[model samples]
Target: MSKQRDYVLRTIEERRVKFVRLWFTDVAGALKSVALSPAEVEAAFTEGIGFDGSAIEGLTRAYESDLIAIPDPSTFKLLPWRGETEPTASMFCDIHTPNGEPSVADPRNVLKRTLESAADMGFKFFTHPEIEFYLFKSKEFGPDGPIPVDRAGYFDNVPGGTAHDFRRESVNMLEELGISVEFSHHEAGPGQNEIDLRYADALTTADNIMMFRSVVKEVAIAQGVHATFMPKPLAGQPGSGMHTHLSLFEGDTNAFFDPSAKYQMSVTARRFVAGLLKHAPEITAVTNQYVNSYKRLWGGDEAPSFVSWGHNNRSALVRVPLYKPGKGNAARIEYRAMDTAVNPYLGFSVLLAAGLKGIREEYELPPEAEENIWELSQGERRVMGFDPLPQSLEHALAVMERSELVAETLGEQVFAYLLRDSRQEVEAYRRQVTQFELKTMLDTI
Candidate 1:
């Protein structure tokens, strides 16, 4: 056995862990777990635990249902929320077929494939996400709507508020799991909050994001509140977004930085931004993957509705944050269109593929959209060559259906499933009688 696998087994015994949960995610990014006894740990490490992949959404067909969940020893961490008594530990798993081939439908493998491409190009992808979500009084809602835990606004510190305590406990739990949180604050909506995770390699960051959501929800429920990563949980309230800061590195040096270049952006960095802008619309179905996701996108606020790039322009889809002089390593681009609800593994895969395409093909970066895009007239935006993003899920899927980049990045299996899923979502939504329709036309005409 590898030293890491041996270490995991030794630690489980030392910690007196009664259960070791093997974790993986479905195509929709929902966490799935299966517990193993200490006796099964060795076999799990060596041969992997078996599961029915057909049961998982977008995982496999019934004919090829049998699959293995190979536990990654390096991801071993004791579940802090599970309590010290009757200890429990968890590790992320990689899904594979019975024949031991990597499952094309496995989201993690999708990302791993993309990262390998980056590795071949002599670059490493890193991401730091500012994840945002809302806290409600309860999961159930009445005729009115779900109630916010508090009425606090952006950065407002509500003394003895449920949200304030929720953030504190959530961050502590994340730290216990070895996930480093960079910042936490109240966001610009009632009961909404933001937690910025420190930068890490793309794969590790994706794993952390899964853990982060679980930790946040666990903390919220313990505190008698409900948490949601729904992109737009309520109308008239700013929606939650995962504005991610992305970078590429070549060994120890930052590939995005060049001190002599304009805005200190290396040619590589500009190409990366160009690539993201060029393909952002096609990838929107995955990044903002729900019918309600469009409500948030078109609802204005700080969400980037148009495809443009600029230094420190929050209104642009891709923004280059100003870094301190000589802090080349800190330089990166923030993609603002993605919501908190996306499957991070798949989301990161398409993004990395897009950026790498720019690097490989040497895409030319366009002029910066210096003025507030929201303030510009549609004609003005047109003259400036700005294009709006897909306005709805239906629109996004249409664009994605034609995207060669996204299809090649996510693999054919996942690509076909996403298209089918999106079409079903749109059809179901169209069939529903919405409250807006009821209210607006119920008594009129």
Candidate 2:
């Protein structure tokens, strides 16, 4: 066996891990897993474990259903929530065909393909995601609506509070599983919370994001509450967002930073930002995938609604956070349009692809909007050359349909599937009779 595979085997034996769960995500970012005893580990590493791909969403048609999942030994981690008596571990897997060809339908492989393009350009993509979510009183909702676990808002320290204890326990569990957290705090919305993961390479960060969600839900369930990553779970409340910070590195040096340039942003950084702004509308469907996601985008609760970049404007889609003194390595751009509900693999892939296109084609960065974009009128915004993001899921999908960049980034299989899926969603939503219509139109119209 290779040394890395040997190490995993030894670690499992030493830890007395009885079950090793092989985990992978579907195209929609749903977590799926299969458990294996230690006896299957060696063979799995070499030959891979076969599964019916047709059973998975967007994976395959029923006829060509056979697929293999090869566990990535590097991602092995002991599940902290499991008991010591019968310890369980987990590892992320990459899906492939029986013939050993990479599955284009696999979201993880799509990201790997995009990262390969970055590797060719002598740049490495790194990301730090500030993920926000809400905690509800119970899993089931009533006529009155699901209740928030606590009323605490934005960094409020609620002494002897459920949320505070939940955050502490959640952070501890994450660290125990080797996911490093940078910060955790209560968000602006009641019951809403945010956790920021430390920056890692794109692939590792995606894996960490998936784990982070699992851990949060696990902890919440144990505490007799429900945690949701839904982008906009409640009306008149701030919606959850991913608010990802991204940077490119050339070997050990930060490629986005230049001390003498305006705002300390290098030429490469400017073009990267330009690319994101230019393509933000086209890629909105993937970043903010759900119908409710558009509710958050247009709700104006610190969620960006326009395609603009600024140094300190939270209302703009892209923001370059001020660089701390002697912390040039921290220079990065934050894309605020994405939500907590997106599939990180595909989202990161499209994002990186857009920025790389900017760098390759030398797209020019637009003038910064230092003022609050939310305060500007439509005419004012138009005069300033600021464009609004898609107002709804249907509009966003229409923009995505014509996007050459998104289509190329996500291979033909995924691209076609997502389009069909999104169209179905819009059609279903159109047929639904909402509560608002019943409340107002029933009596008046």
What clash pairs does model 2 have? none
Which window of 10 residues has the lowest lDDT sum in candidate 1? 142-151
Cα lDDT tens digits, model 2, 1-445, are 7788898899889988899999999888999999999889999999999999999989887999999999999999999999698999999999999999999999999999999999999999999999999999997886756799988898999998989999999999999999999999999999999999999999999999999999999999899999999999888899999999999999999999999998899999999999999999999999998888999999878889999999977888999998898898999999999999999999999999999999999999999998899999999999998999999999999999999999999988898888898889899999999988998999998
Worst 10 residues of 2 by lDDT: 139-148
How do the residues 219-245 of candidate 1 rate in per-residue lDDT, one tens digit apiece?
987888899999999998899999999
TM-score of 2: 0.99
For model 1 the TM-score comes to 0.99
Clashes of each: 0, 0
